[model samples]
Target chain A: MGKQGNYSFTGHIRPRQIRAGALRLRATFCLGGFSFLAFIVLTITGVLLLFYYQPGDRAFASLSEINSVLPYGGFLRSLHFWAGQLMVISVFLHMVRVVWSRAYRPLRELNWITGVVLFGLTVILDYSGYLLRGGQESGAAATVGQALFTSLPGGKALATVFFGQPSPLNGSTLNMFVWHVFILAGAVGFLQMFHFWRIRRGGGVRPL
Target chain B: MDLIESERPQVPVEVEQSGSQEKLPLIELQVREYIGTFLWLGLLFALTAGLKVPLDSSPKAAAISISKAPWVFGAIQWLLQRWPAWLSGWVLPLLSMSVLLTLPWWGRKVGKTWAWIIFLILSLVWVGLTFVYWSESIN
Candidate 1:
């Protein structure tokens, strides 16, 4: 999208590029590409969903209104939900594929570890998404999650940072909303960029 | 030493032939990737369009027993069923992730072997837990 002379992001795909190739495009199920696509869909749908969603005590009621009253809101919500689910599945399969191919050897070891952390973050991303819906199930999840968080070291304080201190039911839901839409999403996006840059630096997903 | 005799004349290659390397433009590659991404998005949109987002009934006073963790946590939840939350939820998850992060240092052979072992055990545990949870739920 920049000046052809500069060739910033597009530089990775050039023929003289000693690092990567079309073979990477040809091989395997293209899980990494599919995962990125899923993430894009999730982001777009999530942003759209944000416009209609209200946090806190009215969250559940607001969601119900989005489902019933807003035009295409239900479809948008479903797309966001399914895209998040797809990202989780694709990212996992992608990891398994990399390990199976023995592509994480030697210089690629750090990328592998980064991948593991990315996987954990993806799981948290989905978990926090559920928390955003603010239904009975989500409320129950928060309760159990809070219990789990409180059980760890300095857990009380850490839990406050992560999920906020318990307040009225709505109060906690608002906190969860902030974490889900902003905090966790931002972290995952940043880490994924690192993950890809590392992949390129480490020689682009192994030959064939 | 006969250094003059050993030094053979170097042959010059044709510049045109040397320049004829088969490298595609980066834009071509971007187009291909974009096509695949759009196709995936189209299929995903169609799938999502047909399905409605589910909203469970509102919270009630007696919602605890029915409350289950998300499906991804089903396996970990089962561990919690059999052990303390600190052990199953916190300690085990942390241990497994840390082990995974440090796995590649074991060298390719040992690392691969251990990775498979860990993966298999986790998969088996998850399957077993899902089965148990299913049976318990149905009954």
Candidate 2:
């Protein structure tokens, strides 16, 4: 009682006095943070991939050049491959942690659905990334994975937008690549923004 | 008396803090924590199966092995194999939605553990059906 303590700054004050478990919250947050890190890793490697890698053109030559000649090209490709797989894995683990905690109940349902939407986006993102390359495995993935497209009633028009014009790196494939790399950014942004908004709006899950 | 007393959440903090509360059961631990995790993982795998995400080869190469459907859709895959596509694709989704929607009421009566167990049992059946889908692949 030597000195009366000043009230916490209104700006800095968290409103609720959380005198209980913060570690769980931090752990869940760490899972999400790691997912973001994986995403960043994928993005960096993807961009580096674009430098020596031509999309849809001499698919074999471009890959061969990258593999045989470009500086750290092989490393970049491997990094992209591993990062994509890791991001998918991390996102799955993050969702599991959230659901198991019963954090997705009630007021958080919409956000939970958004989480599902984000999960779909992540799958689509990985799937689309494969298309840009469209090598043998990617080609097999595209064909056998035809179920990736939902209700392709419009078919040709949409396929062009998604797969590009199916030319020698021209038409719909490259355009699709542009959409995948750029427009998909908006969807990912929505995922993070809405996710945090719901948590802030609904407050967090009760500690176990 | 103490066990019955703990039911009232509004009990004075001192009373609620009484050290003699009963611990939850083992299945309670599993149903509550594990079911959701398993269901989601199952769904991820099931979707990969549906898309046939090429485990080994490319379009030029054919899929030589049969793959499982995503775990979430395992139930539907099950019904599709045993029942009909209309039932699996349409009716099954409706039924599952109803289960999830009514979960709170069921949870209230049966408790979360039983509710979780029931849903998990449904999920397990779904996973079983995915194997049937795998058998149909025959390549």
Chain A TM-score across all models, in listed order: 0.85, 0.74
lDDT digits (tens) for residues A1-208 of candidate 2:
2222222222112223221232234436445555666676666767777776665544546766776588766656656666566666677667656645555556566676677667657766766665556444454334323332323455556555666544322221566567667777458766766665455445342221
DockQ of 2: 0.08
Q: Worst 10-residue stretch by lDDT in candidate 1 chain A?
A: A13-22
* Cα TM-score per model: 0.81, 0.57
Query: By DockQ thresholds, what CAPRI class is model 2?
Result: incorrect
Task: Give a tens-digit lDDT track for model 1, residues A16-122.
Answer: 33223333554446777788778878888888878878876777788888888999778878888888888888888887777776566766777788788888888
Whole-model Cα lDDT of every candidate shown, in order: 0.69, 0.52
Off by over 4 Å in 1: A1-10, A13-26, A165-172, A205-208, B1-24, B60-64, B108-111, B127-139
Task: Report the C-alpha lDDT of model 2 over B23-127, residue by residue, as the tens digit.
Answer: 333344234334444543354444433442222222234434423333333345456556654565556666755665555556667876776676576545654
Model 2 stretches astray by more than 4 angstroms: A1-20, A25-29, A145-152, A165-172, A205-208, B1-139
